[model samples]
Target: MKDTIKYVGLDVSKEKIAVAIAEEGREEPRYYGLIPHTTEAIKKLLKKLGEPSALRVCYEAGPTGYPLYRLLLSLGVHCDVIAPSLIPKRPGERIKTDRRDSIRLAHLYRAGELTSIYVPTPEDEALRDLVRAREDAKEDELRLNIA
Candidate 1:
């Protein structure tokens, strides 16, 4: 519905993704569940979240990179990659876990308290990856030469 927006937060890691969700006019967000970290799993997650048009997803920028953002964009869903350092936290809030993080993300996202990082196009990401690979290769060569 045009009058409401659903906020989805994902705590993404190497093996699984922790999902949380908050709907418009709700005081608390809900922890959806954990899902595998794969394209197919993400597809299933999207399906469980209902219509994409009413959903806006956000996740911290971590080791997963921009692939998830790209996937959501391609699926016609709005998504944001937030800088981890920029996320807000309450005073003395030291407890950290995947589920809690996801819940906080969803709540903050719905409250407009999170900042989104710029998303790179596929071509730009590919170019950057190639450059990084070349740098790694050079480092390996330097190590072998020294040895």
Candidate 2:
């Protein structure tokens, strides 16, 4: 049998990340754990999972942002930044946590059941930053005049 690829999902936060791994053809995740949210930690996770080509990874888009995506790209690992709103959740399912979130992402990713957002190019992100800063400055100016 050919070597099976593994799917990894991450629930990223400011200081830590929850990771889940699902091997191909497996319906359940094979591993799950937490790691510090740092470039070095990400690299170490990639190393622990073995060949870059054999791993597919994903994480939801949120306040933590796309730095991880860029880092994974730099390492030649395909990583999807999923749109949180677009992910499917069972109706009436209310309890949620980092572990459950990552595990769900892993299962969904392996089953081809998640939607991803388009990642902006570096130049595009820079332009977006400028526009945001301008908007913030305008808001500040308006607040000062209102005072």
Q: Provide the TM-score for each candidate, comma-separated.
A: 0.86, 0.91
Quote the positional error of residue 28 for candidate 2 in Å. 0.8
Candidate 1: tens digits of C-alpha lDDT, residues 1-147: 353788999999989999999999866999999999999999988887778888999999988888889899889899999999999989999999999999999999999999998888889889999999999999999999999
Please give the TM-score that candidate 2 achieves against the real structure: 0.91
Clashes of each: 0, 0
Candidate 2 positional error at 135, Å: 2.4
Candidate 2 per-residue lDDT, tens place, 29-135, comes to: 85479999999999998998889988899999999778889999999999999999999999998999999999999999999999999999989999999999999
Q: How many pairs in model 2 have backbone atoms within 3 A of each other, for residues 3 or more apart or on separate chains, i.e. clashes?
A: 0
Off by over 4 Å in 1: 1-3, 133-147
lDDT of each: 0.92, 0.92
